[model samples]
Target chain A: MDQFDSVVQLLDSNGSVVANSQFTSTLSQSELLGFYRDMVLVRTLDEQATALQRQGELGLWAPLLGQEAAQIGSARAMQKQDFAFSTYREHGVAWCRGVDPVDMLRFWRGTMHQGWDANHYRDYGYQIIIGAHALHATGYAMGAQLAGRVGSGEAEKDQAVMAYFGDGAMSEGDVNEAFVFAASYQAPVVFFCQNNQWAISEPTRRQSRTPLAQRAVGFGIPGIRVDGNDVIACYEVTEHALHRARSGQGPTLIEAVTYRMGAHTTSDDPTKYQLFSDVELWRERDPIKRLKIYLQTKGILSAELETQLAGEASALAQRMRDECRELPDPKPSSMFDHVYADTDINLEKQRAEVEAILIQSMEN
Target chain B: MAQLSIVHAINQGLRRAMDSDSKILLMGEDIGKLGGVFRVTDGLQKDFGEERVIDSPLAESGIVGTAIGLALYGYRPVVEIQFDGFVFPAFDQIVVQLARMRYRSAGALTLPITIRMPYGGGIGSVEHHSESPEAYFAATPGLRVITCADSNDAYWMIQQAIASDDPVIFLEPKRRYWQKGEVNIEANMSDALNMYSAKVLTQGSDCTVIGYGPTVATCLQAARFAADDGVKLEVIDLRSLSPIDMSTLVESVNKTGRAVLVHEAPGTGGIGGELAARLSQACFYKLEAPVMRVTGYDVPYPPSRIEDDYLPDAERILDAVEKSMNY
Candidate 1:
């Protein structure tokens, strides 16, 4: 049996004030509205990408439909220097990292080789291999520790790494290994597992009978769970975790309890495995809608601002359609580049031979 | 200037690499104060300290996966997998992220990570200890696969691997780890023959025998036995697998018109199979006999008692060598 009792929620789902503990926030109306705005914008981008996939504009699409608050709230919670290693579905987090929407789309369209340039956004490319990036994130955090980037006198100066993987990925051996190393090395990083239930037809029950956060305690790292739909709870919890990491308090596992409102990808049919009622039950805790309602109650959202944001979102979606369709296919010859830093003589010969073959075929 | 075994040479190499580069780190299960099962990483933790020579959790994937992070932070990480068979756990990280990172990053990032594994069966070891899994990495792009045949090669090749900007899969012949040889630490043998070039361990104009790692010694010993019957056999040690030392091989096969590949790995889809196909393409016109392979049977590595039958010994290699020349 698992030991740590998951901090089930530091906040409630009803858009009401709940936790007034040390983790409680002191945010004003404008700041709260900004978080909501960011969430809504990222959701708009995700919806646009999904629509593009439906229209055959994307080769692949991993939807984060209901997990917006989990991603956005947590990403917004990170400081500027805090690095991130994310799985492919962290489009919301990528947006928060300031990645160009076009560069991100190019990856979905299968045109560009990589999703985002790390130098451009300071966010690593979307890692496709499941649970593998957790190790990379931990190692980087260890590197940060070695470089004297962590445990600095200044709290704001110290940096932490947030590694994003899902509940499905929690079962991966690498993720578990990462926990051991992170614990042993005292790496300054956060293991963020967005437990959005399904891992491609396999439910959370299939992954673990117990909650995923409880798995962290076995590794000697304290774990927590938050109401993933409640943006405020996610923000507060992620902030606290990041704070712990930066303060040289070692690694923490955050199991964001949420739901995947859409299919795993454009190729999946959720109806085949999951029930409609289960999906419907989670829709009430919609990440975007809860934030919108909260903003409305606080007199934070205006009709004019809403209309303007909607107009901008539609324009962005249309531009994605136009640009994604126009992104050029990578040149066949260019595949030979970047395999090795040097020419390696042998690869160059192979490249020449291939180019000759390609040219001969064209002539034929 | 001192003589050392392949295992000690490797230990010295690690000490030197870490001593030279502050960014260099070593991690594996029992590799710290316990000094690895083979003692290759012995005393490294004590000399370099725990931070540098780390004792990772007993998880191969985590070791390699975390090494990727160390690489990303400009650290040269050398990861030791306890055994070849255990490396499969980390195979996903190697193929998906480590191999493809530079290509995926478009050269903006490089994983100068070296994954060290003790491969090939001979010492009557139990299951899950003896495996020649280098073929998997050789098949995967963005990874350079190499194996050291002797102590001298072990001394220099490891440093070359460390200096390489790409991810390297370094498979050490565990059975030969204790075999002693003179190693000139000052000598730069990296460019001696060539990184990917096959070395002519023994020269013969009649037929060629190709092998790597532990099998090279066996092939050379077999050539000496074959020489008593006046069969002048040419032996080639394939130091690197992925970018095969084709020029030296093609030249030899073209002269001999007959060749045999040997290894402890299986016959089908083995390095021998790939080398045979490439030879067929490069030296087809020169062929007088079909290139044969003396390798372990096409099956999973059997029990330690049966391993002698599974491995390609001197007799098996000479058997193939004689048949090819007879053709």
Candidate 2:
């Protein structure tokens, strides 16, 4: 467990550089600023989504309140061809993948299960079944290996796959099976675990006696632990892992040590189980706050820039709210669509029967 | 046309499908080298190479969940579950993930996956090897459950299932794997009846006997025995269990005025129960008696010594026919 102990961090909580950092020289000032901006934007989106849920605009919302860097940094590390399988809470990752915030709300509003086409963004939609997508990512990586799209010497020609899950998901059978298959096949995939401290009222300790990253060694896969609040560390580690996967070095396990500042979901009440002190302790290591501090200390953040970003976030949130309100009600017949690539005669008959019953009820 | 066992026919069907499509791959435990416990996949690995005919690790969920990923990546993966009872470990992946992906994605993704499992009893296997789990899969909304009674359908349906855009649960009767029948190698894909349709194996006028998978042969035998007793019985092989070819069943029941449903699964809440209820409603005016079902008792499959007694045989089916005639 201690082999990967040193949590790779380029920036400390107080916005000071750690002298022996590997990513400090690699990341440019503008790119660092961009990371900071993206983190703040995602945090703002999280807050708005939570507020919408409270007001009944959404059925539920899983807030990515404190794990912005873990999601954004790793998501930004992927090449255009690389694919990601995400759990439902990775709103930060979705934002980084260029999925419009409003489009993500359709599912929460009960309009549809998936709000966007996975093919359009090269990223799978939110997988609600915990840890299931890990196997999917491993299998997709195997497919890439078979297609001669993986293990190429050139990075551009190689495609790597990534799966995002919470610490709780490490205990799931699907995730464990994924580890076995990924390692045995030497699949070109990365298992990104955001150890966000709490899974509904249960802490990470309840799920594992050892750190999650150490579990990778048993599967014969290399594991890396990083300070999730440090955006630079997250980006650097993810880029290195993805490069290894692309170059056919096989899979990597990344455990991003982070905290969730809010309830697990809109319906959850963290005050019932977690201590306020614990939340306060994590508040000091806020991913967005640390990056903002780093940008300010570097003379990259100005008063005018802060005001402009705040305005942009508010405008985007407002547009999302308006669009969500105007979303059309679901049609009963639409359920019959897409059940199969080609609907058979029996399904068509059932659909018609349902339509007739619905029409009869409406007329009466 | 040539005489072949159901096992060899399936092997030929698999080989033909793989030969035609580069994206078709096979994965299962012991399927590559050992040629499956049933040897249904014999020589496939040698002919197709280990890459295409992969011998997967011994995790059922891993087999199915990874197959989902492979399907998403544009490969039509045909996974063998080894046996009927072992499929439970993969039940979550099949019921929750593979069955729901296309509907959840709203057509954004299609899983052309074929999960083949040797099902049912009478070969005297150990515990957890003889369960007929067709009802559980047929109850699932997004899946297509299919079973074959002869070498011809076994050969054709395996290829059709691989060609289908939807996920299919292809159930093979383990006890009937060696049943010999004629297989037409020249049959065209477009000409064969859609795999979902039922087949009237024998025509008669006195009564209708409906069965699928393992019980189809029993019903055919019952019909042959009924012939000597001055009673002609119509035997219908329900090829597809889910979107059950109701038209054929309704027509048969309409003409016969009585129908007998047979299955090896437990009687209560079985496919027989569902078909009996539906046929009663569909053939209400034409029926002479209640739709009768000759099924295994609502109990766990017993020891191999009494396996014939546990499973519905020609006698039990004939008894049901006699009871229906009296009604």
In order, the interface RMSDs are 18.2, 19.3
Evaluated on CA atoms against the true complex, candidate 1 attains a DockQ of 0.02
Scored against the true structure, residue A161 in model 1 reaches a CA lDDT of 95
lDDT of 1 by residue, A72-139 (tens): 87898899889989988999889889986777887667554475678567688787666888999999
Itemize residue pairs with steric clashes in candidate 1.
Answer: none
* Model 1: lDDT to the true structure: 0.81
Please give, for residues B46-140, the per-residue lDDT of candidate 1 as tens digits.
Answer: 88998998876545677899999999999999999877877877888999999999888888999999989999987654345678888889999
What's chain A's TM-score in each predicted model? 0.94, 0.97
**Cα error of candidate 1 at position A341, Å:** 1.7
lDDT of 2 by residue, B1-327 (tens): 989999999999999999999999999866765677677888998899989998775457878999999999999999999779778879999999999889999999999999999999886543456789899999999999999989999999999999999999999998999999999889798888899999998899999999998899899999999999989999999999978999999999999999999999877679998898889899999999888887765545543434555587887788789989999
Per candidate, chain B TM-score?
0.97, 0.99
**How displaced is residue A126 in candidate 2, in Å?**
0.2
